[model samples]
Target: MSQPKHATPEQARPFLEAFKFFYQINDASANFFMRNTYPISIKKGTMLHKAGDICNHIYFITKGAVRGYVNDNGKEKITWISVENEMVTSIYSYYMQQPSLENMDAIEDCEILSMSHEKLNELYNLEPSVNILVRRILEKYYADAEVRALTSRFSDADTKYEFFLNTYSHLANRIPLTYIASFLGINLETLSRVRAKKRSIKKS
Candidate 1:
């Protein structure tokens, strides 16, 4: 039977455990679902999955941060950033069996728990509850992405800045400034100007 066996501490303060149990794992099948996944320790700036690759795994960030972005020629554009208590993946590739146009990379020395797509399919067949859990995770990802799209398309610069700061408060200080600027869809110089304006207002 599958079980979350003897896992090294991924998080000093985990929201739940390996799978982030939203509820009690009362059935053996549910426990099995949890056990099928394993941990992946990623070095800072390492690529978890690269562009044009089939996304064969789903990653749950147990520690540190991850970002999924796309490249245009040599220019990289950050699209998504996930931190502890979150999951990251090229979901479109995973679900549609297509090549991923984005790359998933670590922003820090990170600990991740991942399950192969085939293994998760097996779990879904053995226990349908596992499918529900996967569905919920997908839902959250879509919802967050949709929010970002809406904000970027409809919101003003100040509004976007406020949302970005509110959503990822510490990210500006943690990640490279260039990545942060890209993630916000702002040019580095523009981001610098905005920061300077904020600091000026604060000093006034």
Candidate 2:
């Protein structure tokens, strides 16, 4: 089970650092933002949000990893993976207040800062700097998404695995190969062969 509790400054450090990087705000505004958010600890395999559920909050991963995936005729297709210092949520569902088509799950035991949709809107209205930080974050994710779209469509299995290594090499050994294969839009055998081929190249 995921427990949502008041977050201490230590637990909120990642969010604070990210926020300060883009928009430096005073203690008062920062405090207000802190008060509205909470920390949650979830074990691996926990489903943070499920398809058909309205995603009520956006999460900032402080530890571990999560993946956004969808059921495609009983098959699970990974849409994206997020690790620490990154934000994860069903974007359209959170922004439009609609049921999500994607499901978010923890791939490893995770600690995350969560802010409800209501509180997020309040912050947007009251704190102009929040908008600046969010805009910058969104712009970054948008660019990454564009790269992912192009790579998934045009790249070969080797190129895709190489791109995944460049982008998420840190997670390569941390998470399951099955999840990585799904995210890369390749099968397990192909990923295994690619790994073996890469290993041989490195050795030779």
Candidate 3:
């Protein structure tokens, strides 16, 4: 996640729409916990968090995509991508109560609902059902992270790329070539060559 957090200009609409239903937030919980909920929109390539910044909010993407990445010597590497109907956060920093070392960013123009860290925790503590919802959401992130780790170890770059394309087809057309290369653990040049090869075969 990035350092020095800043709030977006508007509330995220699509996110809140889907999320309100996904979590099944009844009138009681909605009135009590998320009364201030609203929409926030971010353009592509916007940094959600910078290195060394504390994560104070959880972003639920209702539209577009989000990714977590790290930068070293001007080179950016993508570690995770969260898309529509998914939750995105700077995990280590948010839970550890420290500054983040990585960065979270938007890959496409996005609508995300930002929920305060403290407020969410308070709701979880007070409501048992809400607590379960929060736990399930966290579990999703954990499981996805594990899948990515396993894929990195057991698959080759081309296989990984193909898997990513087939599985997250919604993302295939929206992402940039550089980020896709980074996600597949292949150099951009290599990815370019592969794309060219595919084009050549299609033409033939």
Per-model TM-score, in order, reads 0.85, 0.93, 0.81
Q: Report, for all candidates in order, the number of backbone clashes.
A: 0, 0, 13
Alpha carbon RMSD to native, model 3: 4.8
- For residues 1-204, could you state the per-residue lDDT of candidate 2 as single tens digits? 855566788777778888776678778678876788898899999999999999999999999999999999999999999999989999999999999999999998999899999998898788777788789888888998987786588458999988888877788888799998998899999999999999999999
Per-residue lDDT of 195 in model 1: 81
Q: 1 or 2: which has the higher lDDT?
A: 2
Task: After superposing candidate 2 on the true structure, give the runs of residues whose Cα lies further than 4 Å from its correct spot.
Answer: 1-5
By TM-score, who's the top model here?
Answer: 2
Candidate 3 weakest ten by summed lDDT = 4-13
Q: Can you write out model 1's per-residue Cα lDDT over 87-134, one digit (the tens) per residue? A: 778989988889999998898999987878888788788877666666
Output the better candidate (1/3) by lDDT: 1
**Model 1: lowest-lDDT 10 consecutive positions:** 6-15
TM-score result, candidate 1: 0.85
Candidate models: Cα lDDT each: 0.76, 0.88, 0.74
Q: Which pairs clash in model 1?
A: none
